[model samples]
Target: MNHQTRLQALSAFLKAQRAKILPDSVGFTSGNRRRTPGLRREEVAQLAGVSPTWYTWLEQGRDIRVSTSVLDCIATALQLTIDERKYLYALAQESGSGATLLKEQLPEISPSLKRILHELRFCPTIITDRRYYIVGWNEAASHVFLDFEQIPSEQRNMIRLLFTRKELQRLAVNWEHFTKGFLAIFRAYYGQYVEDEWYERFLDEMKAVHPDFNILWQQSDVQSAPEVLIEFRHSKAGKMLFHLTSLQVQGSTDLRCSIYTPVPDSSTEYKLKQLIERK
Candidate 1:
């Protein structure tokens, strides 16, 4: 996006976020009548330790340079989540140069990588792009999860399926927590690609179909891909736990391999073995 557009987006985002905060929540007295829903611009300036005039100018999208420290103060005053804070920095152009660049065209998965995914007979593995599109998976993954082959290629997004696919939802033990992690991770990626049309369209479609998606997205929470333990309930395998590990592809910018390793000291390993063997 152009400088002008970015400034406008920043302005709108600030106003929307401000509208969500209540006076009582921030320890302010809501005496009688209030014109606006959230803290006023002057109140935000006071909390952020800036002149009201300057803050107003910033909100108006005036051509101004915002320092990192000032941005942090504003973020704190707004009670922005980590992902939201990063997004604020990005919109203000106070973040790193890399945040401004568009993602490179996704490269095709190499034969070697496909072989690696296929060779993992025990571990259920799947590959996803930066946007959580399920680009590839192994048979074991199909067995543990749903059959990706049955789903249309265009609709193979992991996030989309997580919300829309009933079978996948049944597999996850804690559906709310499971979906939130994916949403948070997706939100972080959205911050980087705010200018991308695909992200905008995907979000709009998801929000339209699922009310929960709209609500969770408004929270603006963010999380990096960390090692996490996930429990799954399969019809044949029963209760199984897996250590989910995500690895970045060595040569590709977008490709990430997510492997579900059976957690040790549990029946998960034996169950997975039997399940895979029967399949």
Candidate 2:
């Protein structure tokens, strides 16, 4: 296909994927009469840091230059996987083929890795990539987070839910800990990637709804915590204390897995016993 044809295809792919957004999913309210898809074009434009007019042109595949920096920004706005991100860069290429950043393939986790975690059933374990997609999990992991499998793969992003989904806010018993991750995840994106329209677009959207976000955005300091101790009221496990563990990917160093350990010999253990027995 011609370069223009290629760009249009990729751009259309992104729009189709994004148009399924729910207003509350992105921290907006869809009025009754608004007949647009998930989020409006303006919402995506506002969040992605392009003008409605310019971004519309992009969706239409106008001959405007699509820079690598812009693609990185768009990638963040769309919450793309590293593989998906590389595809974006390839399509954004001006003339010919270009190197796609990030790994070609992430090495498969050894069978030993799964077996080791399986033995520690009380230690809630989950393997998630940079995109925060759950890749692996143990029973404990299932107990800690509710309805994980029920969530659509695209909507699994923690940051999107933290700000948009009401159920998540309620489910995440440790709001502070989760909020910190949200801050760190977005901050890391900003640090490794370029400053683009997407940054401003999210900021503006958050500012419209959450003043605290605006305050934090201005400070520009985000902390990443490897170990998290939090309490959750699980449907099956009941109220439990968990010690969270996070490990970064070895080769790409982009993926992360987190395991939450139940506190030793506590009432939480008793509660878990009672709940599991009842089932």
Candidate 3:
């Protein structure tokens, strides 16, 4: 979709989702009879910590210079999952262009490569496309993502999960920093497959969620892999920061091998060891 249409869609989507939440669902008692459908505009405004006038303007697609923190609050109010939230940011990126292609399209993952990842199962690993789609994962990687298996087959982008799912937020040791980097990576990876329909659809979804994503996407920040330290707030294992290591697959530039490295002599390692032993 074009930028203006996408922004309007985002505004409408937020309004629709906000209207669906009964005050009781978000913890406000409603004793009066129905006026307009769903919770009053004021209710959502209060819950999201935004002014009612500002919320209305945002819904109306007028003068919304929203910050990530405010958008985060709105996500919480709207009960968006992490994937949805990331999609929201993607749509709200700063770029003005239509979806651009980063990587050339390729056929499906080869059996030989799949076998290799399986063999490397001891390492926490996942094979992702340029869009950060969770194309394939081994046992160790799968174990870290217990909830991932439950996601609808197509909705498997890591950044999306980081925003929409509360469990994802729980898993984030430093969510804000992690998420910003994730967007930067997407921008870097854009040259690979930005023209793909799936990538555009991903952008559209974000536009429906957060305007900030639209702004960021327009800025076109290159998303090459960086020296990343990620904080994983694991459910059973608790929290730790791991350095991320990424390698592009030989034949397919879009496919990547990313490993998580534990810090030396850190409590995180001890935690991982104990967690592994228990399993």
Candidate 3 regions off by >4 Å? 1-107, 119-122, 211-220, 276-279
Clashing pairs in model 2?
Answer: 21-38, 48-197, 48-198, 49-197
lDDT of 3 at 185: 66
**lDDT rank, highest first?**
1, 3, 2
- Write one digit per residue (lDDT tens) for candidate 2, span 1-279: 344555564566567646656777778888897875776667777888878887777777777787777777777776666645654565555432222222233335657778967887666677765434455666655555544677765555555556666655665586755676556555444333332334434455677887766665543333333476777766555567877776665664345667676678767666654544554
lDDT of 3: 0.65
lDDT of every model, 2 decimals: 0.80, 0.60, 0.65
Estimate the TM-score for candidate 3. 0.55
Q: Could you tell me the TM-score of candidate 2?
A: 0.49
Compared with the true structure, the alpha-carbon lDDT of candidate 1 equals 0.80
| Lowest-sum lDDT 10-residue window in model 2 | 95-104
What is the C-alpha lDDT profile of model 1 across 12-123, one tens digit per residue? 7788778888988888877677888888898889899999999999998888989999999999999997767888887787342333223344346889989998888778
Q: What residue pairs are clashing in model 1?
A: none
lDDT minimum window of 10 residues, candidate 1? 94-103
